[model samples]
Target: MASPGAAAAPRRGHSPLLLAAALLLALAPSPTTAAGRGVARECTYTLRVKTSCASPAARTSDAVAVAFGDAYRNEAHAARLPTTSGSRALERCGTDTFRLSGP
Candidate 1:
């Protein structure tokens, strides 16, 4: 009992929920593979730390220490980042590069 000129709603094979689920699955990160089992791999990280020079005491005499790792307990530690060479600081703002390897 509808008008003849009225348009019919379109049907799609992919529903909104199905499309959303597919998109999420596509964007998900892939799990790590075991291809290199027992083999050691190294990871290098370059960290750059900057301090605000606006303050009169922008520089610090204390040493800077860094520690980082993954959730699985794999970690790297540095007792102190080399900020100075002899009496003079290498640079107020500089980059520290380091590498860590593990099996």
Candidate 2:
């Protein structure tokens, strides 16, 4: 029995639920642990990645990342990976690290 214009309008009932979810997510604690702040012990790991192109001297300005996962799908990602040379020297990329929890 609704009019054409009323049927065409979007529903408003979900807005409050969405807003509450956003607020909860904003107030939730981040999953990352600082170097010495948490009770759980943490470790630092180093990974070396190599890429091959048609030209041996060619390099890319693209950002490189590293990720590893376990059988249960738990994953760790390193978004600030720096380029390295054959002699294990790091390129002049800035050092930054990011951490989050998800699949």
Candidate 3:
């Protein structure tokens, strides 16, 4: 028998511990990228702002903006900035109140 300090008895080809570890690593999967909270970050958290417009603002865009071959359309949306127009982006100061947008 080899002394306790000597090299461990050689196995046939592979060891059970190594096989088990390999199986565990293969089964226990991790995220490809650094996984964030299960919920998506861009999950439509409506941005809010307080402002006044001269009149009801209308949607208008100089150029056509399309994503994934889908053309965005504006219907009966009031508070939200249109697919073409934006509220927080267009907001500017005029006289007294902080203007969120213009009409």
Q: lDDT scores for all predictions?
A: 0.42, 0.38, 0.26
- lDDT score, residue 32, model 1? 52
- lDDT tens per residue, model 3, 38-81: 53121112223222343233222222211211132311123533
Superposed Cα deviation of residue 94, candidate 2 (Å)? 19
Tens-place lDDT per residue, model 2, 1-103, is 7876674544554311111001111122335645345444233443433232222233444445556655745455667555445523222322223333333
Better of 1 and 2 by lDDT: 1
Off by over 4 Å in 1: 1-35, 86-103
Misplaced by over 4 Å in model 2 are: 1-39, 53-57, 72-74, 83-103
RMSD of each: 19.9, 17.6, 28.0
The order by descending lDDT is: 1, 2, 3
Determine the backbone clash count of candidate 1: 0
Q: Highest TM-score, which number?
A: 1
lDDT leader: 1
| Candidate 3 residue pairs that clash | none
TM-score of candidate 2 to 2 decimals? 0.33
Provide the lDDT at 56 for model 3. Answer: 31
